[model samples]
Target: MDTVTHTFFGLTLYAAVKKEGWSRKEKTAFFVTAVGGSQIPDIDVISSWWDTAGRYQMWHRGLTHSVFLVPIWAALFSAISWLFWKVKGWKLYGLGVLAVLIHDTSDLFNAWGTGYLEPFSTQRITFGTIPIVDLTLWAIMLGGLLYAKLRKISRPHRVYKLVWLLMACHFIAQSAQGYALYEQHAGRYEQFALSAGFVPGQFQMIGKKNGVVEISNATAFTEPKLQVELKSQESADLDKLFAANPKAKTLYEWSPFVVLVDNEKQIGLYDPRFYRNGQSFLFEAIEKDLKQGK
Candidate 1:
């Protein structure tokens, strides 16, 4: 999820709390607890400055986003809130933990996955069922906000809680549909990647098998339609590429799946899931010496 969405999650979590009978200072502390924890995991972005070894690709959503780090972030935020507002309670710590959990878990639904189990495991877990920016979530949250405002409800927090229910339903629906489509063509492809389509229930499914890649659009209610087909030259020598662009090597290792390219003049690899229109931004190449690796 994007920073804005995470920030919204924080705000919504804060709003969903029943803060009645609390002092102004206490409310402020809880507010900081919710919003701060939500954004804190993203602190990994700062590692890019010191990353000269192409580890930034692995660092961006790395250790900081780890599930193991959730309680650590929560306790840190709780301590800060305790010092600043003198509001001491296990509730604050629990809120902080939930906020951070929401941040990390939401990221797993997108194609650009997070290192959720990092420090223990570097696997980038992604369901690729939801877009990085899901308008459906925005709409659901905004609609809840609007209804709460208009309905003269006794407990507006309930509305926000319902919004959470809606968000969960949306995620489950998207994931289930994507899983069905991926299973639909199960034994055919060696690797598969799913990208959420702009329209709900539609997905761009990328499958790679036997050095060939297939890109297609699939809908839960209909059969998949072939969109583009690409060939992957996996046998191409990547030693020169690894020697030239170290980041390319990191990308190759970091990505869940990739498309290898061995054009006439150069050899490279790119993530097929990011293939948009004609090219992929992840494409990394180095000039080829046909005779060297021959």
Candidate 2:
């Protein structure tokens, strides 16, 4: 899913855990430590994708996104929490571990599919669960969290635990939709490597229409997965891309500027680093080859 969704999920879970009796100062420290751990996996993408090579070899949620790293990563976060917050012993460590778990859980449902076992393999997994951005989910979650911060339970304790219940319900609803979509397309999906959105788990059908596609999660918040129009009905552009590239076999012949999808889902895409590997990707050289690969 999108980073915003992950941030909100982390916020909700981290807030919920503070009910375990930590001081406001300690809670803030815990939050900082936890969010850092949560955001760590995505850090690799900056260098990998934007480097001179433009190599997506370690882009975004790569090996750092592995579940196996949870233990070591949690320990690192815990040590940071202990030092910065002056927290003692196991309390800080426990919180850090929980925070990492929450981060992984958040990714389980969102789009972009996570590489939970990344170190072992680079496979990306998604339940085809939720849209990357869902305004309804955000409104309910962020709004209620803000409301809780504004209202007081009884004066001495300002924390409101009710928000947790709402979060739980929202997660449940999202999972239910995934199951429903699975049930609806079981045969067709299994017949091919297919992916479909599952959040709010509604039974609405989705497919291409005219020059575009539409998606309905039975919720106003969910937007279409991708909207595309064929520049040529015959896919002449694709044919030319394949014909032009010397390393055509290496790059699956996909236009990265187009919609994102795994290599397995589609065939022929260029490795991002192909153009960036050397200085040849420069404007003059690129324009020289635009006729075939653009």
In order, what lDDT does every prediction score?
0.89, 0.50
**How far does residue 162 in candidate 2 sit from its true spot (Å)?**
3.7
Please give, for residues 1-294, the per-residue lDDT of candidate 2 as tens digits: 566766766566566564456687687766775567666666666664445433353345656677887777778876776677765557656656666666666566653456688667656565545555666567767676667766643321223246556656777776676565555544432111123333344423333323222323332235323222222122324444445443332223212122112222232332211122221121110122334533
Please identify model 1 stretches exceeding 4 Å from their true place: 288-294
* Candidate 2 local distance difference test against the native: 0.50
Candidate 2 TM-score to native? 0.63
Model 1 TM-score, 2 decimals:
0.95
Per-candidate count of clashing residue pairs (backbone under 3 Å): 0, 9
Query: Model 1, 234: alpha-carbon shift in Å?
Result: 1.3
Candidate 1 lDDT over 136-179, as tens digits, reads: 88898889888988987889999999999999999999999998
Which lDDT value does model 1 have at 223? Answer: 86
On a 0 to 100 scale, what is the lDDT of residue 9 in model 2?
60
Best candidate according to TM-score: 1
Model 2, residue 12: C-alpha shift (Å) = 3.2
